[model samples]
Target: MQKISPCLWFRNEAEEAVDFYVSIFPNAKKGEVLRSGESGPGPAGSVVLVNFELFGQSFQALNGNSDETFNNSVSLSVDCKDQAEVDHYWEKLIDGRGKGLACSWLKDRYGVAWQIVPELLPRLLIDPDKAKAARVMAAMMKMVKIDVATIEEAARG
Candidate 1:
């Protein structure tokens, strides 16, 4: 068993969310679906929770009858290899459901925020010269995820 797991609370779309999430991540898998029982907190036979994994991280999505409270404070960060990978995820994830901002922040239909960032960001931001890194950080602060090329340019300047 994994030492840590992220438990997500959905209004009533635990199964659907799990399916969508599994489809997006490369090594994702839908493990099990637990239904409410006679002694369960939910109505008997109704889907209560879904167990799944995304990029090797295990998660549990609960079908709780409550309002969703997902915000920008907590977002899934997708470390992409290049612009193509970032674009693909941005297009598919944003689709007609979520709002897309410059640099790579997007909110899905479920109101979950995601940062489609390039894998090169850290290397560029942690430059030997503090001034250069600071400039890059300034540029990144205006962005959500971050563009690899833009950060590189900022670091060079």
Candidate 2:
């Protein structure tokens, strides 16, 4: 039992969202699901809450109203080991109705924000050469999805 878990609120789409998320992550799966009862606010037998895990991180999905929606204020960051890994996630996430944003940020079909970043990003940003680091930053700012090779080239300049 994790001490704290992020709860995602969906407009009666918790089940679908959980399934989508589990399918994307290798180590993820659905756990328990609680359905609303006849006297509950939602339709009887409809999904009320779902427990799941993504990359070993526990999370709960709630089938609530659309009064609240996902925003960029909070986002999940995926640290990829290489450009291939970064591209894989970036492509997979934006395959359906997702949109790509600048600086490796993207919003999934469910409006969930994700940052697909390469592990080399931190190393490049903290490089001893300030000019190289600035170049990397400038290059990253111009990209919707991060290209590790491009960043490396920028750092080398």
Top candidate when judged by lDDT against the true structure: 2
Q: What is the lDDT of residue 101 in candidate 1?
A: 60
Q: lDDT at 104 for candidate 2?
A: 89
User: What TM-score does model 1 achieve against the real structure?
Assistant: 0.87
Q: What is the TM-score of each candidate against the true structure?
A: 0.87, 0.95
Query: Which residue runs of candidate 1 sit more than 4 Å off their true CA positions?
Result: 38-40, 101-103
**Per-residue lDDT tens digits of candidate 1, residues 34-135?**
998899777899899899998888889988889767878888888889978987888778767778765578988777788898887766678788899898
Rate residue 157 of model 1 by lDDT: 89
List lDDT for all candidates, in order.
0.82, 0.91
TM-score of 2: 0.95
lDDT of candidate 2 at residue 83, scale 0 to 100: 90
